[model samples]
Target: MHALDYFNARLEATISPMDYVKAKQMSPEKYFLIDVRNGPTHVRSVTIKDANVIPEQELQSRLNEIPQDKEIIVYCWDVWCNTAAKVAKFLLEHGYKVKELTGGIAAWKEMNFPVTNSDQGNNIPDNCGC
Candidate 1:
């Protein structure tokens, strides 16, 4: 089965940042990144490469915009946030293959992964903590 069918709604399996990094390095063509934070928060925070800003609330209507055949990684602000989880649940319900980006953007930067501001894709933020 495809990655989408395995996650999002069904909760059968999920992926982590380490796995994501591995994918980024090995299979960029097979993965898709999603930033589920609200637009304003996304604008104010760091973002990952290839991640699209699709707030959790808007996911229902925008499901088609996400590819069903690729591994999707979703993330929000941090541990206290559930936006990413919610988006994952919604995707699971809608039959989209999706996984929550572990640690959200917080974990991404913690691992020293690269990120960029929404306004301009330059100066990728230091995995600097929030």
Candidate 2:
């Protein structure tokens, strides 16, 4: 495929921070936001509020927890992080509709979007003690 075609195709698998907000506003239930940061990073950094906490390393084991009906939107710490992309790709390969959050949580924070600090790691699901 041409470079432009490749770029366009790649864009389809990603969502911008602003567009994410709009999508959530339009239909909150249509998307399933997952924070793929590891336990340590997630505890120290702020994450998009209400995002399901599933560290990248734990994804395979937690795959069943992800809802198949909603479009998965995965995000990591920042633009430098590739955890989200890896997780998105895994989900796609496993037959799930997924998208990586462009620039990750850093871009979302740069956009001044709503976020919740996870000082105590409470964002993680009850079943996960980490």
Candidate 3:
């Protein structure tokens, strides 16, 4: 099977960028946004507003930091990146409700969603320079 097929077969929880936006707008409290990128990449790139940074390498050990009640939505750099899927799989196997964000942060920006960076302003540029 191809990588996409494998991912599709193995994962059931996923949220589209538009759907995520709607959820955030309709009820921001319903889910928790998690960025699974490493620290360096996270620092260089823009992230969704209010997203929690839990690098994929540390996610297993840091599972305790995530709340059990809320749905967890994970994202990485982009659709090609598998980190988000891996994190979502780990969370699902661990009995936490989870969803991988389709296309990751890049897709979010492509859809004109809001993002922030420490060095940059509140709204991330459309190009992102990622």
Candidate 4:
């Protein structure tokens, strides 16, 4: 497929960070958040509350761990990164509901949403603990 075609296709599968925040606030149970950044980066960076760390390279192997019932929202570093799109596409092809976070973590942070950084000793929010 042409580059534009690929870009357009991925755009259709993405959710804006603001929209995601609304969804998360209105119905947190409807979607699962996935962080597709590599381990070291993930550890150093803050992530959306309750997001699961599933780096892109390990996603396929960890497929069984993700629930099929909820929509999955994947994010990487920022808008310039396409890792989330790749993972979203893979999940969609595998029959799982998925969407990419339009601007990734950078956008999320820009919106002033809550995030937890393990390196900073911040309390990581747990879905079950909420």
The most accurate candidate by lDDT is 2
- Using TM-score as the measure, the top candidate is 2
* Over 4 Å off, model 2: 39-45, 119-130
Candidates 2 and 4: which is better by TM-score? 2
Report every candidate's CA lDDT: 0.71, 0.81, 0.78, 0.78
Give the Cα error of residue 112 in candidate 1, in Å: 1.7
**How high a TM-score does candidate 1 get?**
0.73
> Per-residue lDDT of 21-66 in model 1, one digit per residue for the tens?
8878887788778877764443545677667866665667778789
* Model 1 CA deviation exceeding 4 Å by range: 1-12, 39-43, 120-130
**Residue 74 error, candidate 2, Å:** 0.2
Question: What would the TM-scores of all predictions be?
Answer: 0.73, 0.85, 0.77, 0.77
Off by over 4 Å in 4: 1-11, 119-130
Decide which is better by lDDT, 1 or 4: 4
* Residue-level lDDT for 2 in candidate 4: 100
| Candidate 3 deviant stretches above 4 angstroms | 1-12, 119-130
Q: Per-residue alpha-carbon lDDT of model 2 for 3-118, expressed as tens digits?
A: 99999988899989888889999998999999887645444467799888777767888899999999999998777777788888889999999999998877888888899876
> Tell me, what's the RMSD of every candidate?
7.6, 4.4, 6.3, 7.0
Extract clashing residue pairs from model 4.
Answer: none
**Pairs that collide, model 3:** none
Q: Per-residue lDDT of 19-113 in model 3, one digit per residue for the tens? A: 88888889978899998775454354677888887777767788899999999999988877787888888888999899989888888889888
